[model samples]
Target: MSSFHIYGHRGSSGTHPENTLLSFQAAHKAGAQGIELDVQLTKDLVPVVIHDERLERTTNGIGFVKDFLYEDLVRLDAGHSFSSRFQGNSIPSLKSVLEWITSNSLMLNIELKNGRFPYDHLETKVLELLTHYHLYDRTIISSFNHYSIQRLTQNGCKVETAILLMEKLVEPWDYLQQVGANSIHIECGAIDEYFITNTHKRGIPVRAFTVNDPYQIAALKKAGCSAIFTDFPLVAMQSI
Candidate 1:
């Protein structure tokens, strides 16, 4: 296997329902070194592994995820929308994912989805869970909401934190230093050899997101990216 990390974006989402345990297991079977997943608090303040603030996109449930309690959220079919083969797969809690992860050596990148609805104590809650599971050393916390990332650093969080970006910046490393972030997780197109090389010169790692094309994957790897988040881990692994 290549030294470059290939994290299954939402756990092999290209082949399975995103964020479900089934998807996670598939990523593992495909030899992914890590998995990147989204985290948001349920109505009950229980953190769950999902990508959206609303349920309509990935789940059978209606309305916002904040309106449903964890118990109610789990009862809904999380995978049926993807395919009939995944008819019974329910939304996995952060706790459940942590428990499952104990059985494997996969590293985790947990993206705090607080940009839409800022969940109360989301940073502390996720930190507590990581503490309980003894996963702080193996996890990387990232967020589009730089405030949450700042909160993690200000509170002296032990886990590595990365800033998620959608656009190119003149000097992203300066922004990273300002936010006290450990690394960068950016849109794939926004990164190139110069960007990756310059960022690495500052001793910062850059990981691109949602990169699925084999050509792009090879290019990023050649550019010396620390990692690439892809929906097809097997294809990425093969490309490298």
Candidate 2:
């Protein structure tokens, strides 16, 4: 059963704030076995953990996350929409997350959001960070951008990689095999039991994203999914 892992999507985003230390803490407390987070580099080449190209949705800041330096990003309030419970939280660096993640035997699935990867020194820099923390074995790199995953794997990262798809895929396993990825991080809206079955037959595990509803979680389990990423890790722990 591989322990039927629950990965907190952008941390326990439903209860705490999204993409902040508070959210990841809440997820860990909520009993998530892993965390699924996005990584985008700054102009200074800092790997910051966040989702979205723009900061408008989650934080009080405007403009692109990639355009800002690490100092500029750390000053913004990431928990603006979540009320007083998490008022001062800021978006954390990938380095910050690596330090905290070592306290437990938790797994990390980091999504590379940058395009045009094989990105000069970017892949090496990311690998250096993971190696610094000695977390290569406990981590899995994922991406919708196949090149990023390929670049990282080719550079001899000890971690495995996962392929992401937000749309319905025909012959998805072919994509996974071609990318040298053994796992699929599927969008919940586009998956079906047949997809899961076909993926499983190829010895690949399928995990759906952002699943919160009990019925949907039950359905995913019945459909033989390997895992799920959820905003509601607390709800998921209960449902699963």
Candidate 3:
């Protein structure tokens, strides 16, 4: 398709409370075909949807997320900004997100938040959760951690995997192919026509992240990006 598919990066974060159920619903309302979110493991190793390592920025809780168990993390108010609009909204589990995605027929980009502490079973757990929700085909699991993506790919999981990056490389597609990834999504600041065309020539889809600028978003489109991730889904729809 010539029109690039739009995804709500953390669920239309510009309009609604970010990473909250309300945000996902708002993203859907904004005509986003896909929803992208980050996943981190709690102390109990329960996969919870969040971005940062600490809860202080988005929630009422203090301290690193590694210090808290899944039970405690989910109890904290995740809808701090839109408290009135989404009272009692808490950090959701992968299972919950999977259910929501499947129920709404939304494509999903599942980004694995990398961290220390001997992360085991993270790839398996994510695959299992997606399988439990019957979303193997509709979801794309992505990460900057190459090993994590390799693990998921080796497990015979049917989901697509994308390599995420920030910096520019001389041969971007060759670099990604070395890691066995067929898709690459880079930060908007680092994307260029050469990078896009090189990646497309390798039979890999190129996407740009967090692009909100109308002119820059148009540039990414002209560069042959298969999709674009943005916090303002409505603005993206308007542009694309």
| Count of clashes, each model | 0, 0, 0
Each prediction's Cα RMSD? 1.4, 1.9, 1.7
What TM-score quantifies how close candidate 3 is to the native fold? 0.93
What candidate 1 gets wrong by more than 4 Å, as runs, is none
Q: TM-score for model 1?
A: 0.98
Rank by TM-score (best first): 1, 3, 2
- Per-residue lDDT of 19-63 in model 3, one digit per residue for the tens? 777788889999998999988888898888888888887888898
Q: How well does each candidate superpose onto the true structure, as a TM-score?
A: 0.98, 0.93, 0.93
Best by TM-score: 1
Model 3 regions lying over 4 Å from their true place? 1-3, 81-87, 115-118
Task: For candidate 1, list the clashing residue pairs, or say none.
Answer: none
* Cα lDDT tens digits for candidate 1, 25-103: 9999999999999999888899999898889988889998888999999999999899988899999999999999989
CA lDDT for candidate 3: 0.82
The CA lDDT of each predicted structure is 0.92, 0.83, 0.82
